[model samples]
Target: MALTNPAFSTNPAFKENGQAQTAATLSAENLQQMYEAPSATSVQTDRMTVEDTIVKTAICFAFLLAGAVVGWIVPALALPAALVGFVLALVNIFKKKPSAPLILAYSAVQGVFVGGISFVFEAQWQSIVIQAVIGTLAVVGVTLALFASGKIRASKKATKIFLIAMFGYLAYSLVNVILMWTGVTGGTFGLSSDVRIFGIPLGVVIGIVVVLLGAYSLVLDFDAIKQGVANRAPRIYGWSGAFGIMVTVIWLYLEILRLLAIARD
Candidate 1:
């Protein structure tokens, strides 16, 4: 499911007249020369670019990894980290402007949740964390390559389907959590485990579908980034793109981890 970050589209920099208008009297030759000028680096102009977005994403991941290491060493912090991360995520998502500190903070806290939960799952599954990590990376790598190659693109119809599926998944997840908490379901995965289709756990199917949804979400992220860069959005918005990507990747990893665990069981 795609977590829409308003910072990408709601910002004024992307709107008409947000940027300075070019001089109308400028000659065609002058305009051509200006267009041919060296591409603006992040430091050169406050405009967005693919490179800046990459750096922002790398920074977020670095903070995430650092926090993950701390969380892995102290597994008891998982739930608390998750709660805090959730609140921070909401704040970042709803904030009018993208704040680097808040985005980084969210990444760090989410890392703690990821690491602690991974450790807990690894303790029982023996190497499942590594598997999930590799799986997540593989999926991301392939999706990126496909997108960069222009072999895949997001379409309005597909996005509509994706949103519908995401809503259905959210509903299912809510009910499953309720069942688990109320002691109505007798398995670790609640309805996902209790229900079977063709002798396979329902989670396996749901997990695969969720993973596909996550993949499409990545495509949307890429599309958003492309639009941002093309529109010469403010560099600060790159952090918003990075934040969206990190959230999607984390969701992808968790879903893959759960799917693997269910399969192993």
Candidate 2:
């Protein structure tokens, strides 16, 4: 039961052989200690677990929050941070093994980018950052609740559609960016603002759709983590789960932020 998310799919740690690999490296003394131990936790056994993954995710977010505070104070670092974040994200995603330091670096860099952008948005629209935060939290909370209740799930058919939509959205976004850079479109959001569908700004509609995609991405992240746990992946692989969730949540937040900005305009 492999997941679609590149973070999990490309990593061999989520495979059934993950635990065997860990065991192979253990010394006789370590095995004896484990056998003599009254009870061993997931950490003691060096196996992936949901609780450990949650803790790792929290630690990553904490670093992100700290970096965001710095970015909020100095928004000029936004562009550089974004560039660094993108590179780090690519590195973390394709790396054969999960690296906590690299993942944390990516999260921190992305936080700076997020904070810098939020500050810029807030300058034009008062309190927009807080509104975006609330909206993001609401969406995440509801999505998590539904997923926990088994009301929502990731399926092959839905994931295939998601990938298709992702490609289309990327293409549209690239075109929009080029138009804005070349001065072909005018406004803060380029085509999203200049174009209108049924008297509604094109950005507003696209934002809603993209937000849904982001939400689905979250579902995929959650499913991937669940698979990793079930597979008894190495404890270190928990960082991969955290990284995946962070990526999706940041994406979701940005989409919601842009959507709100377009609506306000």
Candidate 3:
């Protein structure tokens, strides 16, 4: 017969001698009313929610766009921005708790890198930026639609595969960079551009696979957000969701841009 409602259990009115007062004296009607009362909402409880996460994500993107403008105007800052952003990304990923300022800062720096790279690519291939943007949007839109429709879902097995693929891609990228720096390969994209398979550039084939991996990574991000909401996580954690989405989307866009550039070559 003790007060069972969490909202009232801690109230002094419901406590007697530092212990919860038994509701034995209360009428059955009162107990029924209390039981039937509406529960607290996510906002009232300060919990994570889909709408809040979306708003946070949008804010991060706004910062990104603003930084991108500066990067476009001064392409020289691209390399430095990329290095700083990478460090920030690692910090954010490894930190136990989410920090809004750090996450937003990472977004801004990443935007600079994105803008600088886009400018470089555009200078070489006219309209390629638009093409990459369209391609990225298409992939994101389709992936989101599939997720919302329950056609795509994250599974342990698939995530394991994704991690393996990501590691492989990273290793290959590192080797390619080394080769480029050492002048082992002449093309802009190193092996990706220099090698060919059945008259098709190796980059085109690898790019297609990487694009699919990026899409699946998006799926994982969506699933994580959904889980966070379901678990009623703290509201501040929404920034983590925003950060994850931004990282995935930016990676996806850059991959698409590179793919288009290689294909055009």
Candidate 4:
């Protein structure tokens, strides 16, 4: 139930041959024309399709799956793979121009990281890995359904709340890690075990909330893709879309894994 990698904007008509564009070069009249939408601003991207996202995501996942197999066979690559993936993730994020090869390679490295981690966790919890996988699929499926039915959407208010929640969660995670590292807590799972609300672990609650956030992220991704199409953005933004989906899926899987671990514990 992973989200498909998003496709690039299909607006080849407005492209500047993969080169960057700016107002300093375009004439006043050209700029004026560029500002105007080809049709009504309110027009929806009904014509655009989500199929490409699926295809591209499948490709990324294929590479990931392949990397996982390799990871299981060669445990030594796990640490290096994770480090490489982290660096690649940063590089991809800061790069103004999307490089397809580099992005795909990043996916491969991430595959090894994910596979190795999953292997370790699954070994510890036995069937819990399966449970987490099912949970991830269920969450992703339900979110997509809600979105397709127009029951869920990304609004400014929700986005604002999401940002605040993410920041708070990050801060809490940092504090929790510090607590664990400083030997202030004797819990096995850090804040996940030490902090419980009404007998329920904090991590479980946080996981559910974060799952919703990831789903909303999908909505935002959709909105961005639609806007890109309308804006006649360059084709490479497809890589951007793919990268975005990868990020969301990774986050979702990690959250699911944590939730399952807490449940098993």
Worst 10 residues of 2 by lDDT: 1-10
Candidate 3 lDDT for residue 56:
93
Runs with alpha carbons beyond 4 Å of true place in candidate 3: 1-42
> How much lDDT does each candidate structure score?
0.91, 0.88, 0.86, 0.74
- Name the candidate, 2 or 4, with the larger lDDT value: 2
List model 3 lDDT by residue over 42-145, tens digit each: 67877778889899999999999988888889989999999999999999987767899999999999999999999999999999989998999899999999
User: Which residue ranges in model 4 land beyond 4 Å of their true spot?
Assistant: 1-49
> Which parts of model 2 are misplaced by more than 4 Å?
1-39
Top of the candidates by TM-score: 1
Model 1 residue runs over 4 Å out of place are: 1-5, 16-38
Clashes of each: 0, 0, 0, 3
Candidates 2 and 3 compared: the better one by lDDT is 2
lDDT of 3 at 185: 99
Across residues 75-132, which tens digit of lDDT does each residue of candidate 2 receive? 9999999999999989998897889999999989998999898899999988889999
What's the TM-score of each model vs. the native? 0.90, 0.88, 0.85, 0.78
Residue 58 miss distance in model 4 (angstroms): 1.5
